[model samples]
Target chain A: MAHLASFSFTSSPSNSASSLSPLLQSHQQPHLSSPLQDTLINIDNSATMTNSYKYSVLLPTYNERENLPVIVWLLTKTFQENNINYEIIVIDDNSPDGTLVVAEQLQKIYGEDRILLRPRAGKLGLGTAYVHGIQHATGDFIFIMDADMSHHPKFMPEMIRLQQAKNLDVVTGTRYAGNGGVYGWDLRRKVISRGANFLASVLLRPGVSDLTGSFRLYRKEVLSRLIESCISKGYVFQMEMMVRARQFNFTIGEVPITFVDRVFGDSKMGAMEIVSYAQGLWKLFVAV
Target chain B: MTRATEAATAIGILGTIYLALLFQWLPITLPPTIQEFILPVLPWWVLVTFGAYSLGNIGYHVMTFRDCPEAYDELQVQISQAQNDLRSKGIGL
Candidate 1:
């Protein structure tokens, strides 16, 4: 009878549900746990194991053909050291300088699953590239950073750990925060960056200290929600995302990261970009 | 209308008429002193009317510029079709 009881408890749910025989129910039926109970317990265990989430790193590139290989190496090293399950999704905008070729080589080296190359025709702007990349990302969490090596991969592990520790919806890297600094920036560049951030904060009052920094990790669903709510494009896109995040009451965490100037290729900043940044700020101030 | 509003509207109308006459070959010009002083202290109605007129002119020109290239291509197509039809009907331009 003890053996039968053990067998009944270990059996599947269908078996136990059917085994509630009329004969067993007739005489002062002792509380007999069935195979259904064991099956339910196993299902719960499997569900918990399946819920262990991984991270997807989205690197949007234009023409950083020279910087691609080195940045991928750094990312691989960082994720490997942290023992985190992560995938790097490269969203390239069809760089004429053979950036896709280098990306293909990286994919071969790191297996197709780990390195995903999502390329678009022409330079279709930064905001859309991120949206396109996010559509294909399979991870529960998404990390966005520059592919130009300006945003270091070293800071990513800390951002991930902090997000995990606090259960934060978003973790952004700030250059203006404690122990964080920008290297290879002249006086004019620093002033422009600082002034832009100040102006945006004054107008929008986004709780984040660095509204323009693109290096951050977001819960995949949270990012999808935020991206849909945002309207601005190009450099202003980052600022608007933070503003929308605050409006939606999403929890945000910040980590200090040293932003280095890209060693390869020319800086994409220009006079028109600054003008558009100002215009974007004004639009957000009035619209939001 | 209140006296102030009447006076302001009158000034606006007079100024616009004066500008139209000047553009249409009227041999009249405001004295430097009047131009410097009176124009600076123009009433709100006068200033707003002038601004509206300027904005209307700008909007017209902007629309024209925006549509000119496409409009020209469309006109060319129409003219070519007309010429072909005329030739088919044994006529010439």
Candidate 2:
């Protein structure tokens, strides 16, 4: 945690008639040799205005130590090239592999103001991590992506420009829409992905093309409201957010991008997740 | 008096009648000749068992109609309270 030092100044005019007349005379004169002028000059010189639209990237990690440095480097390079004012908030769930240690090192390399390490005790759910990260974010827009290199930082500039051009409330990357494709998945995996999406669309009728994709950019308040309205956790959480976005009447813009499997570590998808996805779809179908 | 409630009540009554018919058709302690003769014709036990089971089923329907909806509403309230508590503590389900 970074310590913030705040300095406050208070001024009160004296009630003495002589002091009051001098104060009034100083105000009347355009240039006066008074302490008030010195203080005002000091304040004007000391305060510096910062740029607007600081982007906060919320990255939730569990055991992503090896991938942390590389992702941060990519993000830095991309932001520097585009001249985007940004900060990366790493929300680690206290991985046993010392992911926080790496994040701290990155903070030292890039100033603490640019990189923030917000860690929790143990493995909490993904939805909670985003909520926690957003609380500390100072940006007007929040970007969420995986730290496993599955989501590239190169697409960020285009996403921002496209969002500005269209004035969209949310911009999402879709793998199943128009020229976007998935690679490195076997026939069974592809079939399961397509079938699950089809089942959700048939039941919920969410307007988004890819309901299960997680790479998204949202206006900070829009994401907060959508997260509050959503009910599903884990893999189904992403689907629920999109469905709720449609429910609340938010404009959504989709950008086609290829989704590649993670380059490092193991995939988190399992049989239980598939079963839970089906059950969550049924629940949303009835509730929403 | 809704269609769903009436259908549920009808199904409950039919299930009770089926159970009574099965119990009467299969007597536990009957002489072989008497059982054979009675089983072949309309048995006296069938009517009595049907009467008891149908009455029991009708009692269940009346009890459910009186209390089931309120119980369901209470369960929903409990679930909502639990969700709000989790959210306040920064825990997401």
Candidate 3:
């Protein structure tokens, strides 16, 4: 488990689970032994593994309580199968639906070292959530993905493999690429996403097929530099990151991914998001 | 080197050779700095390897996909188990 003092919890859990799991209840007791030594050597590499690069999954959650456990389990299974050293930094923005409680349960199951819960006051923007998560991540490669279960962990190994094989600075999951597509989205959403990507490509010339994809693996330093260079605050942040990466001359790779719509809870995207994306794209074209 | 890297390297070398030979005989307005500084530094293989890689990909898929089993079937099972586990706890679908 990572040192408790090492984390910076910006805000406390506003609400707790009304009923605790037996494991959590057991944990509530004074003290207990660790989970059967975990037997897995990769778990030992949670904090900056010595030999190989460790991947830090930055899962920014907001009202993702329902989707959290399934995603975490899927992540655990994926990483375990691939034998990758990793940690999950869940940067939650004070979700009211007991999301933090689910996250805490996840931390217990996976060990505190693997799951870092960094909560904040309220619903901050997506970019700031990433900024907060990066501050606490200890991995050499940082993974940014949604906690809403839209982006499955199945494609992660491919992303990592492509990143390694190509010596890539960035490997983003693209739904528009070969063998990649969106599932469960209506015609309107499909059109919007495609139109947005087309416009961004035409204007920015980033050479990346998908500019709005958030599921990406980044070299920690490259991401830090991009974050510093990027000025987009909200929906435009993902596109801005790609644009800045191109201007700064970073090589980005692509892994085709089937992006599924959220299985539970509502998608936060709406007309406002589209309008802001257009505005942000215009700003990026003019500035960058 | 892996197949992809080998492919990339072979294509890169071929493209470089082709460009050099073509430019030697053909009169093109290409800047000298491109041959000296930029082309050498750029990861042209990323673009150059596309022809071989995508062709291989298309051929392989077209020939094999009809008879090939679903490669990610096991992955689908694992995902179903995970979803069911969540469903048991009434957590997620």
Each model's iRMS:
26.7, 23.0, 11.4
Better of 2 and 3 by lDDT: 3
- Model 3: share of true interface contacts reproduced: 0.08
**Tens digit of per-residue lDDT, candidate 1, span A162-218:** 565457899999877655667666656766777677667656778887889999999
Q: How many backbone clashes does candidate 2 have?
A: 0
Full-model lDDT for every candidate: 0.72, 0.71, 0.71
Question: TM-score: which candidate is best?
Answer: 3
Colliding pairs, model 3: none
Clash counts for all predictions: 1, 0, 0
What's the distance in Å from true for residue A13, model 3?
48
Calculate each model's fnat, 2 decimals: 0.00, 0.00, 0.08
How far is A212's C-alpha from truth in model 1 (Å)? 0.7
Q: Give candidate 1's TM-score.
A: 0.62
Model 3, residue A117: what's the lDDT?
Answer: 96
Pairs that collide in candidate 1 are: A8-A35
- Give the DockQ-based CAPRI class for model 1: incorrect
Error of 1 at B36 (Å): 34
